[model samples]
Target: MWVFVAAVFALLYVPLFILAAFSLNDSIIVALPFRGFSFEWYSAALDDVDVREAVGNSLLVALAVVPLSVTVGTLAAFGLTRFRFRLKSAVAGLVGAPLVVSWLVMGVGALLLFSALSIPLSLKTIGAVHIMASFPLVTAIVSARLIRFDRSIEEAALDLGALPRTVLARIVLPQLIPSLVASALLVFAWSFNNFTLSFFTAGFETTFPIWVYSNVEHARALPIVNAVSTFVLGVQILLTFLVWYLLRLRPGGRSAAAPLLPGLATTERTDG
Candidate 1:
């Protein structure tokens, strides 16, 4: 089983490894025979003003999308988890519909919707589309955390004459911090790396991924593209590690999957 798992992981990561290795190859050609180790491609990628601008555009979109998506997603998760309403299940499903849909379909749908509304394709449109794409993932993570939340704690606070807002601010939000942070990081990374939505939505503006896609056809630019791709891969890996760490997989830390409220622990112990 372990061998099989290792093989699967290798299959997934081997391409990324090749991309990273080729990014450092001294040869301009990306063929098998690596001439020697060199940082020329990295320097060239860094020196390109267009690359820098694209990177900045991507960051701008991601920065805008992260807060909006996380805020909406967290609130939506709370609503789905705590409140009973007409068509609640339908609403929850709607919130997650993007996850089941193909990105290409979603991107085209968003483009058509915006076009009908007379909204021009631009960075703002890209950001909006990214928010929609990322919202489901963020909501899923936060809702999972909320499911493990101890409702009794909220009830106790209410019983002690706390207002709903007070209970949420003082009790709920604090417990949800880890999940919120993790969701934000994940959403930000996804938004930064997103290509399909950006491709349809970006008009004059080029994002990092779009820039790479546009230039990858140039054989001479392969090394520089590889370098940029490697950089993106590194950022993704770093964010993944941070999400794992923040979710308390570390030594001596409590699991994010466990109940977050102290009262719940006591209740469980007593019930057990």
Candidate 2:
């Protein structure tokens, strides 16, 4: 088992390690022994107007996706957890199935759907496509957190004279912070790294991944792609660490603690 796990980690991270190393390489073709280390590529990547536009487009897409995904996913989780509705399992599966589907298939389907609807493809259209693709994954993640939740707390909040909106906002939503934030981050990453869907839906407005792919054919722009990837990876790692630190600092510090509500259910060690 240990050997198998080690092999899996190696398979996953070896490529990442190679990319990090090549990002620092002075070679134009990202070949053998590093000729020398220089920030030249990084500088060039930063200065390129096209690279900046692509990065900005990625950020915009992620910004659009995160809120929509979170709102829809949270609502879906609430419905799944709070009410016994028909086709609940089927609904959840349909929402979450995109996580298991191939990106190519999803991309093509999205393109066809949008074309039929006459959405007039653009970066915003791609962002919308990303939201649909990502929402299911967010719903699945948030639903996992909701699964072990206790219903009595919500009832107690209602009994205590809290309005439905108040209970959701002050009681249920607070308890959902960790899971919600986690889902948001994952959705952001998905939107940011998206290639296939964006490629199809975004007919003209290029995103970072699409730009990177295009730049590969342009020999002069090769190193810039690596530089941009390095920068993005660094930013993502920093943000993830910050979120981890803040969650630990949020009045509980990893022990079993009170729920974010006075009358709500206690927060359980969710890992179990």
In Å, residue 270's CA in model 2 sits off its true spot by 26
lDDT of 1 at 26: 94
lDDT by residue (tens digit), candidate 1, 165-204? 9998999888888878877887787788788888988878
* 1-272: candidate 2 lDDT, tens digit per residue: 99999999999888877777788888888778788888888988888999999999999989988999888878877787768878988986787676677778878898898889988898788877777777766666567667767779989989999899998788777877876776677678778877888888888888898888887887767777888888898887887675565455655575422332211112111110
Model 1 pairs in collision: none
Q: Rate the local accuracy (lDDT) of all candidates.
A: 0.82, 0.76
Give the poorly placed runs of model 1, Cα more than 4 Å off: 1-3, 249-272
Off by over 4 Å in 2: 1-11, 242-272
Q: What is the number of residue pairs that collide in model 2? A: 0
